[model samples]
Target: MNKSELISVCISDNRVCPMPPQWVKFEELLSEMGNGKPPQSLILGYWFDTSDEEKRKCVQQQIDWAYERGLLDFAIEYLTQLKPNQWHTGYRK
Candidate 1:
């Protein structure tokens, strides 16, 4: 899909935060990187869908840091989901 369509899907599905103007720019940037195909899961939940362990760790550390600084209202649900490896998949079949 095009960038606008992708943004509409993301917003409709609650993938990315919809209220912030920066999110539109972020989607634009991601679409550019993806050659117009936005990474759905990453845009949905960066901490949830990333496959790189280092990136996940970095994001978690940042969340922790933000919480410590009172910059975030961190939630346990963020850590409750199974690892990406455990997610069920049959879409490719």
Candidate 2:
């Protein structure tokens, strides 16, 4: 899917968050994230389905960094392997 589609999926997946995260072109949005700023989890969360190609690519590059730091990337990578409907019904063939 394209960047916008990807972003939509990611946000929909994380609908539980009260302030569903969004990508920013401004420093102010980064500030709201926190002092250390845009923590890896938040950054990765904004990565998957962002509408901006540059931002998505940048975030993709940091997936390993986020994973190494024990943030959101770890779980997302694990769950990503479980493709849609592959787990359900037990066997496809």
Candidate 3:
């Protein structure tokens, strides 16, 4: 799937985000990176912030979606390179 299509799927899927507007720009940026480019640090940081169980599960779905579309390796590489942190909901505890 192309970037635009992927972004649409992500935005429409509640499993991806309850508030899709909050993720539109981020998804757009990710789309712009294209399939060949490595995921950027900003994307890594964003994924690292999925500290809540629900959000983590949503992200896991996203990873699976990307994997099905041949984007998993990039996602995995980006995620693996980031340091873990407590960033659940609006709290950074």
Candidate 4:
């Protein structure tokens, strides 16, 4: 699907944050990288006011999860760029 369609799916499925105003750009970025394909593995979560160690652990978990799902490129290129306050993982099958 196209970027707009992907974004719509993400919203409809509650795969990403429900904050449309904020996440529209993020979904667009994912759609661009996906090149019209949907991700096989998508993880979305949030953390707040955590210790550095905890943040590291969360990040590592995201990486490990994406890698095991064969989404290392997406993990490195997109997931790693996310802010610590939120988590997003996506990988093409």
TM-score of each model, paired residue for residue: 0.27, 0.26, 0.40, 0.35
Judged by lDDT relative to the true structure, which candidate is superior, 2 or 4? 4
Q: What is the lDDT of candidate 4?
A: 0.39
lDDT of 3 by residue, 18-70 (tens): 23333343345345554433222223456566444555455555555556657
Residue 61 alpha-carbon offset, candidate 3, angstroms: 1.0
The backbone clash count of each candidate, in order, is 0, 2, 0, 0
Q: Whole-model Cα lDDT per candidate? A: 0.34, 0.35, 0.43, 0.39
Q: Per-residue lDDT tens digits of candidate 2, residues 1-93?
A: 333443343334322111223223212333343233443332445644544444434444333334444444433533244344421111122
Q: Which parts of model 2 have CA positions greater than 4 angstroms off? A: 1-21, 24-51, 72-93
The TM-score of predicted model 2 comes to 0.26
Candidate 1 lDDT score at position 92: 26
Worst ten-residue run, lDDT, model 3? 81-90
Q: For model 1, what is the alpha-carbon lDDT of residue 93?
A: 17
Comparing 2 and 3 by lDDT, which wins?
A: 3
Q: Pick by TM-score: which candidate is best?
A: 3
Candidate 3 residue 60 C-alpha distance from true site, Å:
0.6
Give lDDT tens digits, candidate 4, residues 1-93: 333333343333223332222234434544455454332222234333433344334344434444455555664455334454443323222
Q: Residue 29 of model 1: what lDDT? A: 43
